[model samples]
Target: MDKTAGEYHFTRLETVVFGAGKVESLGRELSRRGSNRALIVTGKTLGRSKLLDKVKSAAGSALAGVFTGAEQHVPSHTVNELVAEARRVGADSMVSFGGGSPIDTVKNAAWQLMGGRAGSRTIDFSAGAAESGRGGDILHIAIPTTLSAGEFTPGGGVTNESTKVKGGVADPRLQAKVVILDPALTIETPAWLWASTGMRALDHAVEGSYSTRHQLVTDTLATKAIELLNAHLLPSLQMHGDDELEHRMRCQLAAWLSIFGMSNTRGGISHALGHQIGPMWNVPHGVTSCITLPHVMRFMAEVAADRFGPIAQGFDLRFDPRSPRSSAVECADRIAKFIGKFEVPTRLRDVGVPREEISRIAGTVLEEVKRANTVGVEVTLEQLVGILDAAY
Candidate 1:
């Protein structure tokens, strides 16, 4: 019952409006933000959907143009192209629709439009500079279409095509100025992607809750996110078309809460490894998180057994507190089994990560020591290699 065992600061989106029919208010929100000329960003699939039509109709003349080239891993060239398009359209503000890729891209583009640089190379994590306003101003609004939960965070991930490394850009100014959470907008999301990303959100909550930097506030959000995701993700995936409203709303809420928790506490080994392997293998962020999460949990159990016990209980892993280590392993295994319910490939090789490349992947991940500052774990290179090997 010691709620304040950890102390930390919490931050979140400036304005969030969530509901079933909330997309109908898109134009009103844009106009209220003093954004008459808005650029809408989405993926190719979402661009061709009726949802895009809905957004266009809602925004009407306030919508300047649409950029549908958002891709997974957020390649640097894509960022530059989108930035050019945003400038070409003379957009005063941006609306990002779709998953983490589109959201992260627009967030970065907005930052660049506000004079931030598209990192010349892969992010140098050693340079932990605080982001300050550069005097250039362009507001950003996010309409997330999946539960990957990038919209609520102030960081964006972009891949350096030259090096084939994905890097993160952390800037408070990159946070969305307004977020409209319309579950209806998520109707177009494919089922596999939806469920896998929901598991990714659950990973965020789990990692954030037990993070060394976790605080009372973040713990509360993480707990709620866990409860919501456990209850809703499967149902959302199972009943996508039949029961759209409640299921999508729950997924949206879970995603938001996951990011809310993570924004404060940072994440753990799962994120650290996923951040490394995702871009290298062209894996989706959520899928990589799903594959690595349980293994990372098992690894973390040695140092964080006490924290794992409660999470085990929450997930209904029945075991005695005296045997916290066993219980923690059970918790990790149970999570892996739960993830299995979604039919996501649980092994790296299942997704085309060749066995021979394991060492190379591990080596690439070892280079991610820069993530240690934020990951809340002193993950050594040897330890990372072990994680990749175990996951393999």
Candidate 2:
């Protein structure tokens, strides 16, 4: 087949194990690879949960030490601390057993440990290290419990606390060698988190559809992800007992498909804003998506109407005899309603983004995009502030 206009690339993870009880295979898998000491990187909540115990049991003697300080936004200082501990313990491998934060932290630590320049040093996204092509040799496993699907991609987002800008390395070596998707482990996740992260996945699918660098294969996966999320996310949110394994699994699958095209393209304004606002406001990635995505669609209606068509169809939206732009605006409305169904906040104010910071946030978005070498979508400070104002 003739390829799309732009180039594309994807990472085929070395191994992916899905299904209940599959997390139990971690120890043997490490042993098979001759890994003797593996560090566990995760957030505080998951570290205290019985799930960590389960991961520890599975890791057996290979479990070296557990770093539970992987906070939201994956601060550069946190990465240095974790890297220090990893070296102190002489860990030979790493396991990221939580959501995006821990996974991103592990990605940075692994990169530093595997001979990247500036090992264990604070990362400055504005320093242009993220766009520099670099890879590491450390073996990392990602066992995700949320739908923020950072595990599937090579870019690891780390925030500098001093600057409050999120950025990190985008080396192929940062990709996880193994990903274990065991829904049983997710039962402990709060319904709000599960639903919110699903919205994050939705943001990925929607943005990928309109990204300038989007390719045929990525569009296909993003569309299917949209369909699956529309069909299953709500039911997954309403799941009562352990019997809803299939719903959870399908949501996880949707999250996977949502960002399956990461190696080729990057998200546009929604993601750029999310990465900035997340570290600034101390908001979760999912909440940022819930608030930013619909407004982004509305903002892009004039430029990317055709791109939103399949997404509108995925949401089962019916259109009248209106112009394509009008139909695209309706698609944005449909996304707002779909997210509203879960009772999450869809406005910036609702997420505690003060009105005064709108311009600052917009400026940060522009700077980060320029530094990261973002392609496809371009935004001026005025346009970004307008989107923020509308969301506000």
Candidate 3:
């Protein structure tokens, strides 16, 4: 099918709630999704926080057990542990609490329960019709505290502890059945982390907008997502009072909308670079976007310049379709300036990737480009290194 003429399939995601204290309705929401027993999956810090208590209280009789073992990057071993725990507790559903890591950890667990294996490259995120029935009965609920919006997507990447390499699974049925976007829970997030993740969401909007598989449905959603994130992210970073809660809510909504197009689009240049460099260097996913997104935009502009019009327009910049390449570069500059205002690291070196390792990292990224159908760009090792060097 042509870009404008492609089909869109609704994911298995069924219910969502958004507000300050909407988490208090977790039990009711669980009922809405036809779930009763839930296993809470989260990291250590939040495992000890009052938010956990709040969620547990809200879960009440529905809570089966808690797994506080979620680590960054959804380590493969953790996925196993979570799987064993979910089975032991007889959990019919999983609740993901925290940012992308724990959310993805739960996704991996659901994937496993539904017969997916960690580190299995043979399993596509959109495993087609024959395998479509696998995860349909396995439910997951997400209560996100950061903007790394893994909860909304069916894909979840897991890293090998020994090799620091990443692999992932995606099946539409594995997407969270219910998502509760509680800005009240997000007030505890560290500012830099929140800001960096907002950039990650922005990356989603920008990437989806210019995707080669771009569709009218996704373009419209991506446009609104970009506009919402562009308007609210910076202000949401420094929450001061009740009014800021609404900004944070907008951010949460935008995060949900940003990756709405992923199912229909190929992974972009930014994602290919970020996917490798992130786990390889222990850089957080959000920080990877801060460093690589603008450079990837500029690099991809050669053939896809006109596709950037929505991105520039999202940033409230003037877009001249007559001068598409220049407009694309201008959009890149504006994105960089927006990222700079967050005071997060804007270079690979700043994020602790050694200067001497650029070539090695580039080789790894090229392999990722080959592995995923990313952006349709024939990226060479030299071009990859050039992008890294520029970011460095």
TM-score for each model? 0.92, 0.91, 0.95
List clashing residue pairs in candidate 3.
125-170
Model 1, 290-317: lDDT tens per residue? 7899988888788776666446645756
- Taking the tens digit of each residue's C-alpha lDDT, what string does model 2 give over 32-118? 878889999999899889889999999998999899989889888888999999999999889999889999999888778876753
Per-model RMSD to reference: 2.6, 3.2, 2.1
Candidate 2, residue 279: Cα displacement in angstroms equals 0.8
TM-score-based ranking, best first?
Answer: 3, 1, 2
Best by TM-score: 3
lDDT of 1: 0.77
Which ten contiguous residues of candidate 2 have the minimum total lDDT?
Answer: 120-129
Q: Is candidate 1 or candidate 2 better by TM-score?
A: 1
**Alpha-carbon local distance difference test for all models:** 0.77, 0.81, 0.82
Pitting candidate 1 against candidate 3, the one with the higher TM-score is: 3
- CA deviation > 4 Å runs, candidate 2: 1-6, 117-136, 318-323, 370-378
Residue 313 lDDT in model 1? 47
Candidate 3's error at 77, in angstroms? 1.0
